[model samples]
Target: MSAESKPLSGLRVLVPRGGTWGELVSKALREQGASTVIAPLVDFGHTSEEDKLVDALHRLEAGDFQWMTATSATVVDVLAHHQAVIPKHTEVAVVGEATLQAFEAAGYEVARTPQDGDNTTEGLLKVWPEIETDEVLKVLTLRSDVAKPVLTEGLISRGHDVTQVVAFRTVGVPASVHIREDVQSGRINALLIASPAIAREVAKQFPDIPENTIVACVGPHTHEAAIDSGVKHTAEHVESDMKHALIETVESVIDQSDMLD
Candidate 1:
């Protein structure tokens, strides 16, 4: 497609949080005629409580838990790295489509995911009772170090026995000097906030965002985080394909700007 036909043409979008996902999103943005700067603002690492993780994984593989829950794809990576196995008897529950895809890619089956537009931790909690329908269930909830205990607490409130484990730690990555300068100087047209952590980093790193610049988030939950972090001019969507949703948000903002011009 020609640049004139592309909605994101002449726009420079910053994609935070690197890895396979970043590369794919960057590639799609390029195809849509947007210049992408892949500056990772957050990353995942090993958790401090290794012994607890090991024991949890052992019990998980031993079929001690009737349901295993994953909130992020990073949790799936951590499980795969430790060669954690989910026995056939134990069902798997996930929050987002990305996490579900990660589990399927890692040879694990997903038993439940939020079908509604809300794909946050609370969304999963909302549908927990309907999914289980039992008096009580043994659930193994895995999450990042910075993740909130909403899922665990919700399951417990529902009369389920839950073991919440910090599968990995979320670490912040500083943007390069050039990237920071471009952002502050308004050279970058928009910023992509993939997670709440990235939103916090963006708010901390660039307190004064340019008036012309836009902030697009992957989902409603991330959008809420961005707004809570004091990010202005932010947009978000709830869709199965997060990349497409973000791209659509950018396109919408650009279209709106064009109309005003």
Candidate 2:
């Protein structure tokens, strides 16, 4: 437990992701002595193209792919739902801390998480593993239908065999009425946006956020998404990595907000 006199003592933060993601953010906030509101604003649904996903999973289990990749935990949820199995020989690469944690929690060992610090396709491409000359790696990428094809295209450009499959659908889940009202009324001091999808939901669900509310994003891409969604959160709210980065960024935001006061 954190000391009650921590920097974030009086803050009321809104964690807009659910499942383990929400739990992680909430726990981190609590550890910083901040109160958290776990109001999930988005949820996953079956992949739009289920048949294709199943076929890809079958190929993956048959060892037809050399490397399998997961960009989000929802992909793992899809695997759990279908009881999909990966051949022991097929290496797994995951992006993002949450996805990596979820992947490990599912009892799978990860082979790579791109050496580049950024958690984007560019990062994966920049540090795409070097394989032996005799082996042409066939890669399976689990993705959301709306996610950009940067990773697939990048892998293809590098001469790797890439099969990109949509494993889940991202859709908005309405926040509880009181949660929405609190954000609108400026009662929640800070809002944490872990993904572009969550940024879109926060923008849509709370179109008129109070100026004092700090809307923070997990990284550059999510920050860009917030901007694209007309989410008016200050440009200073992007953290590039995990728990420590998030906590540091949140504390900075709080300190700056105090300076303004």
Q: Write one digit per residue (lDDT tens) for candidate 1, span 62-83.
A: 8898998877767766877898
Top-lDDT candidate index:
1
Off by over 4 Å in 1: 1-6, 20-33, 125-132, 176-187, 203-212, 216-261
Please, what are the lDDT tens digits per residue for candidate 2 over residues 59-108?
Answer: 98888998988777677778888999888899887666667777888889
Candidate No. with top TM-score: 2
Error of 1 at 97 (Å): 1.8
Candidate 2 has what TM-score?
0.78
- Measured on C-alpha atoms, candidate 1 has an lDDT of 0.73
* Model 2 C-alpha lDDT versus the unseen true structure: 0.72
Model 1 residue 65 distance off true place after TM-score fit, in angstroms: 1.4
Clashes of 2: 0
* lDDT, each prediction: 0.73, 0.72
